[model samples]
Target: MLTLQIYLNRITTQHNGATLDYRGQFSNSRLIVADFTQFVNDIQAALKSAAEKNIYTPPSKLFGNLRATPICLDVREQLADGLSPVEYKVLLETLMAVCNSRAVKPEQVLYHGKIPFQAA
Candidate 1:
């Protein structure tokens, strides 16, 4: 569900009757060469730590791109801040992603704050 943008900008454009979009020196290329496995780990760890810390508020990455950082979510502490739909969706998806990859089932994902959501 990550909407990646890898499009090249227009090669030519005119503003003051002159081209400004195609100057190679003025433009720089950005390649988002990502490691999928590392991305997965980053997200999984973020969500897992959130649950562990009881985070519930919407995170910065929830409505945007996720990065490798220790931005935890303490749900009990964040309920006051509330969350937008986008954040909720992202949080759910993140949790599910971590759970599925770790072989933790849905029922097992919310068990009293333990890894696997709970100890079986």
Candidate 2:
């Protein structure tokens, strides 16, 4: 199983909108996403797609460093094929759970999961 961790560093709300500062860690690599609300939306959409289609396509924005890394669900499976439909659902649920928590101010561990991994 692969372990993934996401931390929400801070949230800034303005009259126009709210921006979230967060980071994700998988293995030795760490990714920082700053002031991106679309990231959350993309995750939610991917979760819906995974549920409806049993397939996950990672968000384009995360395609670079984040997606390039090998975060496998199983030792024998490639990253692309590691996650089962149920696993995908659970992974997204874990993330959404953290997102829904609405923990503001101070850094918070948004998500932590050990799963057969893959994310759309």
Candidate 3:
């Protein structure tokens, strides 16, 4: 049910031209879908305008050897990211136990999951 709620929120929020909330309420998929939709629309509009103006697309070296593929770095995903379950667990635990009130992060916290809310 939470997934469905997130989806509904994404559609309504986007159509209403509201900023996306990613911290708590929105799910990863919801945010991704909404962002991708907007990105596609923007690219389409730009390309259409360029075509109308007869602007030639400059050749890009984004794809190492594949000219046909528009290799955008931001959209590329690392297969190892999903393959590394242990790494993901450690990362999530580190985020959850974050206790900094200031913008800067403190070092030397033990990874045994014993971080107190306050240091002092």
Candidate 4:
């Protein structure tokens, strides 16, 4: 099984758009994304694409900070094996809800769930 946990720490709204500071645990690997200005829109687009294509790859921008690292590959591999397109859509929807909600506290866990590995 693979597990995911995401937390939002702060949001800065600028004249152009909002930027988010967040962190996440993809199974056992931890990562932080700072000043992610297009998080909401990007995730929504990803959700749409995944629905149409029946596959999901975490947005490249979402892990920009970890580019070229083994962790990025690990996350992609785990997600591919552990979740189906339908399951990934659900996860993206949960992420969208968390990003849209004002009631969330800083650093509060936005999502935490297990996804059983999909059989080949």
- Estimated TM-score per prediction? 0.25, 0.25, 0.21, 0.24
After superposing candidate 2, which stretches have Cα over 4 Å from the reference?
1-31, 54-120
lDDT of 4 at 100: 46
Q: Estimate the TM-score for candidate 2.
A: 0.25
Clashing pairs for model 3 are none
Q: After superposition, how far is residue 19 of candidate 1 from its true place, in Å?
A: 59
Report the lDDT tens digits of candidate 2 across residue range 17-76: 323222222212122233235435434443443324433333245453244222121112
Can you write out model 4's per-residue Cα lDDT over 52-74, one digit (the tens) per residue? 44333332556632331111001
Note the Cα lDDT for every prediction shown: 0.30, 0.31, 0.27, 0.31
Q: When superposed on Cα atoms, how far off is each prediction in RMSD?
A: 18.7, 16.6, 16.7, 15.9
* Cα lDDT of model 3 by residue, 52-118, tens digit: 4443132245742233212110111223222133432332333232211122222222122222123
Query: How does residue 116 of candidate 4 score in lDDT?
Result: 39
For model 2, where is the 10-residue window of minimal lDDT? 68-77
Cα lDDT tens digits, model 1, 1-120, are 111111122122222343322211211232111233443355444344433544322235454323322222212212223433443334345445543333323332221232122223
**3 or 4, which is superior by lDDT?**
4
